[model samples]
Target chain A: MSEHDKNTRHLARMQRKKAVVDTKIESAKISKGLLLIHTGIGKGKSTAAFGLLARALGHGMQAVVVQFIKGRSDTGEEAFFKNAANLQWHVMGDGFTWETQNAENDLASARKAWDLVQACLQDETVNLLILDEFTYALKYGWLSIDEVVAALKNRPPMQHVVITGRAAPQALIDVADTVSEVNLLKHAFQAGVQAMPGVEW
Target chain B: MSEHDKNTRHLARMQRKKAVVDTKIESAKISKGLLLIHTGIGKGKSTAAFGLLARALGHGMQAVVVQFIKGRSDTGEEAFFKNAANLQWHVMGDGFTWETQNAENDLASARKAWDLVQACLQDETVNLLILDEFTYALKYGWLSIDEVVAALKNRPPMQHVVITGRAAPQALIDVADTVSEVNLLKHAFQAGVQAMPGVEW
Candidate 1:
């Protein structure tokens, strides 16, 4: 085919694509709070959540992070957002589940974190809430999945919630407006590479 | 077994896990610049890249984003990071390839963006460089893969580069320290939901 014909064909294809996308975009008229889930055994789940936080903060949205199992260490994210305006930070993790080894203590800590999550869910002023590693709490049965899902389902109309962790509950997944599974293709850690300061923290 | 016995067994297992993780961490002693790639049809490729940028900036690192094919729309990310200190942003795409419809114009735009990329690659002051949607430039033959790989290979020792797109070249993946493929199980857009201001942009 000639170059001109190729150009014509491409334009026609794009026209069709644009029409389809426009219809889809138009069909989605109702905008309310979104429950987003990021899961799977891949990397970037929490990282992607933080990216959303940054984006939210960019829009002058008030945000809070309830770290369920990662608050023990000072991460680069915590350092960066420490004094960021219009932001609230809360760390409620004792440590990793295996490291803690005490189910009662883990349960207590998880309950404390869930209380904070409940407060965030009720607060209309807070535009975005990140429940970091929350799935572990559900998976380990530290928190009641039914109760948590109820709270999430009844959150403020315009408050967005993002839950990040592996093996998210089907109940939570069923209620989410958006869900993404970050699949692991290759990771440095698996290859005997340590998680570094900014890269892995 | 009793709860006490279960806890003890868990503690032992955790100790073993700690030893294994610690050994891997210890083996990765070298600290240097990393070439990371986020590819596949996953949702968080650029989102993950931005998360890395946020982490890099959290550490007081200078960063730059050379957006190749996302220059058409004024995205929430751009609005949020436009005035961010210690960061530089450049939008270098005329539009998506099909929208542009002219190969020569697309190639020219891609080349112009490549010039900016080359500058970012060569500048040691840039601690983190994000080549957003760069794979399209390669897939479309707007830029040479060999030249891009060569520049990436010769980057400064402490500068981290993140390439976010789909179908990343094997040559590029071969040089990357970490690669993630975001598998799309479900997308809101596919469910007739429009991209929102801060979430999709």
Candidate 2:
């Protein structure tokens, strides 16, 4: 087809698409907050959550992050965002469950982190809350999934929550407004590539 | 089993894991660079790339971004990273191909963007290069896959490259050290949730 004809057809198609998209956008009127879940056996779940925190901060929104399974406070995200005045950071886990070596200790740490997250949920000023690696806590039975879901449902009306980890529970998935599963296609670490400092952490 | 016994078993398991992880880390001595590809129908491919850029910047590394299929500069990532001293940002595409309506114009824009990316690839100081939504250009025949692969192979030894989009070509996947497919388990947009600012820009 000639360029002009092609262009005219494309414009017509887009006009049809615009009508549909505009109607959808207009129909979506309930925008108080969102419960977003990122999970699966992939590498970018937590990284995606951190990106959202950056996005929220760009809009001058207050964000609070509570890490549930990672013990270290020196991740690349922490190195930069911990100093942000609008962010409240908490790294409360002892480590991975197998590394912690005690179920009671892991449970206690999870409980403590949840307490902090609850406070953040109650804070009217905190616009976004990130529960990093939280699904691990639920999967390991470190925290009650029912209680967590209840609390999330009862959070401030305008507070957005992002939960990131692997193997999210069906209950959590059901309650989420958006959910993404990042699947692993290939990994360098599997092929003898060590995790690089800035890239992995 | 008693709590102490369970704890002891956990410690032993972790010790074994530590030894294995340490040996793997030690064996991975060569660190030239990484060709990481994030492609799928899921939501976090570009977000994950942005997170990597943030991580690189946290380590004081320079990054250059060439957006291949998106034209809008009002994204949250652009709003934040464009001002960063270490980042060289380029929004080169004329928007999505369907939106642009002219294949010649789209091909010309893609070629221009590739030229800019080639310059960045040659620059030793650019530690990270992000080609956002680049796979579309190759898939649409706007650019040559062989030439893109050859240029990537010849990039600076220590410069990392991240390519993000859905349906990445097999050739690109073969050359990449890491590849992740972000599968769409569920999307809010499909459920009548409109894309919100700062969350889906």
Best by DockQ: 1
Number of the top lDDT candidate:
2
**Tens-place lDDT digits, model 1, residues B1-201:** 998887788778878887876677788766778778888886778878877777777777899998998755567677666777899989998887656756678778899999988998899999899999999999988889999999999989888888989999898888888888877766766666667656776
Instruction: Note the B-chain TM-score for every model.
Output: 0.96, 0.97
* lDDT of each residue in B13-127, candidate 2, tens digit only: 8788877766877887666688999889988888888888878877788889999989888787787667777888899998876567566788899999999998988989889
Candidates in order, TM-scores: namely: 0.93, 0.93
Chain A superposition TM-score per model = 0.96, 0.95
DockQ of candidate 1 (2 decimals): 0.56
lDDT tens digits by residue: candidate 2, A1-201 = 987887687678767776776687788766567888889887888888887877777777888889898998767778866677688888989887556657788889899998898888788888889999999889878789899999999989888899999999999999888889988888888787778766788
> What DockQ, on C-alphas, does every prediction get?
0.56, 0.54
**What are the lDDT scores of the predictions, listed in order?**
0.83, 0.84
Q: At residue B148, what lDDT does model 1 achieve?
A: 92
